[model samples]
Target chain A: MSAEGDEAIQRLIALMARLPGLGPRSARRAVLQLVKKKGALLLPLAEAMREVAETARECVNCGNIATRDLCEICADPKRRTGQICVVEDVADLWAMERAQVFRGRYHVLGGTLSALDAVGPEELRIPRLVERVREEEASEIILALAATIDGQTTAHYIADQLPGTSVTSLAQGVPVGGELDYLDDGTITAALKARRAL
Target chain B: MSAEGDEAIQRLIALMARLPGLGPRSARRAVLQLVKKKGALLLPLAEAMREVAETARECVNCGNIATRDLCEICADPKRRTGQICVVEDVADLWAMERAQVFRGRYHVLGGTLSALDAVGPEELRIPRLVERVREEEASEIILALAATIDGQTTAHYIADQLPGTSVTSLAQGVPVGGELDYLDDGTITAALKARRAL
Candidate 1:
């Protein structure tokens, strides 16, 4: 190998390191595996990434990722139960989808309202969500945002924007199967406050 | 997304999960990030993978990854110092290179002699190593293999094959910055046994 070969491998490693979880060392190991198993892993991965690069786009209606103008959920008429589940990002929407619950459509907020970052309603597609609720005549709006301060603030802002709409949030409590001893104070308090008549 | 789009994303996640440190959940996160940052990360990664897939190959001489028949170290005239360091894998070779300590060349054995896995001398590059030592007139053969039983057996076998060459193993003991209280029993014993004038 020449200097060019070394440069090529370094370039690949640098790119791999920028991935969500990978670092320089792990990237090296991954690159080595990719090189060693060219036919079995490398070529197929390259093709998949290329195909996704060519096709993947966010759904214009819901802001969820899709290959077409509308995502599968938005396209399916059966999913429109006159309810809209709002989330901070597409990843959150996917997490909700994985539970096999939520029989309604979604509105990906893209992000939360943050005074520190100057992120406001316009940046989060709040206007579009309000319009959708009015046009679709949605019965309920489930706020599936995170339990963080920013998440709560965003949810409240959205709720205020859509006055008269029945907006609810995910129940805050101790997780199912979670041990009482390991539960945080906030969770324990919330769970006790929201205790059901079971 | 359409069914085809979903399937394409799934394929990418599966391939990512096969990488060294990434699992299904992390793979999903990585894939989502890639999709989100298409121009910044995904397209460049796809191009890099394609380039590596086309150029990356094992050096015929030393078994290290390279773009050409001979690796950079083997191709360099300055590195032929009559000492050939032996390592179990290309990753180990890369580690040694990163240290920038060794001035000699290398011979990557691919793996150690493992009876459990039915690995033998031919499966590794042991035969090539012996022939190289003779042809290159090597003065020393440094075994930088792991301190495992299989690694020791492979090193001894190689030493026996080359009667006249000076074969040495990496010094084993407490690792640098390792605490004495936390050191393993075997390491403490090795460290005590190999105690020298400091």
Candidate 2:
């Protein structure tokens, strides 16, 4: 390859390496495969990226991504079930959707409050979530956050803000299909303490 | 997300899954990350993909990818060292370049001969390689193919085509930093058979 071509490929590899799962070595292999299957994989991916880049936007109501001011879930009148699921990020919102159980709206906080990083409610969408809860007249708010300190702190803060609305959290116990031997001591204790009739 | 946004993201994920080393699950994660960091990763990657898609091409002389008629290694006047390294694909050529050794030009065969797949010399760049050897007055040809049955058969076939030039192959032995305990029986036997004094 010419110097220019090498530079272009190198630039591409560098960019691909920044992706979530791919590293430099795998990125190179991906680029090679893309080049080999130019019409099938590379060109289509490029077009998709361009399209998404031009159209994808954050929803003004929920912080979920959409091609318009409001995301699909927010726009759907049927989804407004007077229940809002609060999550840390859009990925979490997508995960909830994948479960196909949640029929209500969502509020993506972008991230949890981190005092060490100087992140506050202003940095996240906490204020927006509070405003939505009141304006939308939500009856209940489900905090589907991670089992981390920051996640718990954010959940408590949101609960404190919504005095009239009922706020609950997802159950914490052994994961379904998980083996007892694989679970940690804390999870075992929690599961034993929360034991109920099966 | 809205229906349109979901469609675009789903399309991007499907395309990303087609790349080597990426599966449907990982592709979904990657697409989410790309959307989340649009300005930092997604847009720039789209631009790079477009640039490479428009400029990258194959070297007519050696079957290597380049932005021009001839690849950089073939175009370099100093690389005409009367030795051409024949490889199975452009990935191998790039790997050799990454090693920063082997200063000679290369001939990418696209693929090796496969009896089961109905592939033969005509399907590869065998005839082109013969012409290159004669035209360039090459004194040696190094076969850096995989240590597979089909790869060996292709190497022998190429060697038979050029009687005057001295043909060699990459050493088949334990890989660098590879433990003897982890090597297969065949590799250990080959290494023992080809043992030499240090």
Candidate 3:
């Protein structure tokens, strides 16, 4: 294989290896399977990869990914109200929607503030979130951050920043260190309903 | 939403719904996610999908899907060794290699001949397989087919077709009605090397 061919394959392997649960061996197996199923699966996936790589951009307002400059959620006039549900990541936003309980827009913090990792408000999208509240005139902010120490610290920092805004949080249904992806829709719904003012 | 928006979402939902274990609700969630990630993950995936849909073709001889008319395995001189281990599907062929066992070549029999579905050798690549055996002057034909009733029936049919050649089969260690995906690598290697003559 040419260096280019080998590099393309290697680039794919490295990216795949970074996925949540995949390792080098599993990534190789998956790549091989995709190659064999290229007619039905791989080629299309590659095309999708290239297109996303070219067109995908982060939502400037809400931190969600968007094809356009602004994400659909931030652009949609109907979704913008006083209420903004704050989440740690895009996956959490998806989990919340799966519950079919929330009718409000989302504010993805991207990640929590971690002293261990030297992650600050800037790294967590908190500054952008503050701008969203001020510009959009958001009435209420729902903190759906994880129950971990870093998550709590980040939430506290955000709440302090927007002291004038109503702040509530998802209630006691989530287990410690439980990622939103692992929770079923019903659990998410129940947690949203039981949310208390912070 | 406009008709175009609904239609695009609907097409995506349908494809996601057809995935192995996803339901309509999950598909909808997934599509919404794709839309949200369009700039990052969705557009690329769609472009990849379109490309795959356009370029993928199945190997006419062995039923293996490929980028061209013949799969790499079927076309490679290093692969053909007068020994073809028949498998129920592409997944089975992959599982065999995860163990790093099989070295010759593979014939993916799309599926077993089932009386209930009215499937027969004519529906599978059995005819092409017979022709390959004769033309390749196969000395040994190994059946790594599944253990379902239909699998056994197909095996018997193939054994009869290549009566002149030495016919060996994967051993009886496979649990009844079990797909090869669920088996461990050690078990598959043991099964392949200790394969008994029919």
Best candidate, DockQ-wise?
A: 2
Q: What is the clash count for each candidate, in the order shown? A: 1, 3, 13
TM-score, chain B only, every model? 0.85, 0.84, 0.90
lDDT, candidate 3, B1-198, per-residue tens: 321122334454554454444566555555555655556556545554444455555677777656578766777776757888888876677677577767777788888999999998988888988888888788888898888888889989899888778889888567788877678888888888889888
Interface RMSD (Cα, Å) for model 2: 2.8
Residue B182 of candidate 1: its Cα lDDT? 36
Ten residues in a row with the worst lDDT in model 1 chain A? A189-198
Off by over 4 Å in 2: A1-5, A172-198, B1-5, B172-198
- Residue lDDT tens for model 2, A44-147: 99999999999998999989888889888988888856888888877667656755556888898888899998989999999898888888889888886665
lDDT, model 1, position A74: 90
- TM-score per candidate, chains pooled: 0.87, 0.86, 0.75
Candidates 2 and 3 compared by TM-score, better number: 2
RMSD, one per candidate, in order: 6.1, 6.1, 5.2
True contacts kept of 1: 0.66
Better of 2 and 3 by DockQ: 2
The global C-alpha lDDT for each of the candidates, from Candidate 1 onward, is 0.78, 0.77, 0.71
Q: Score the docking of each candidate (DockQ).
A: 0.48, 0.49, 0.15
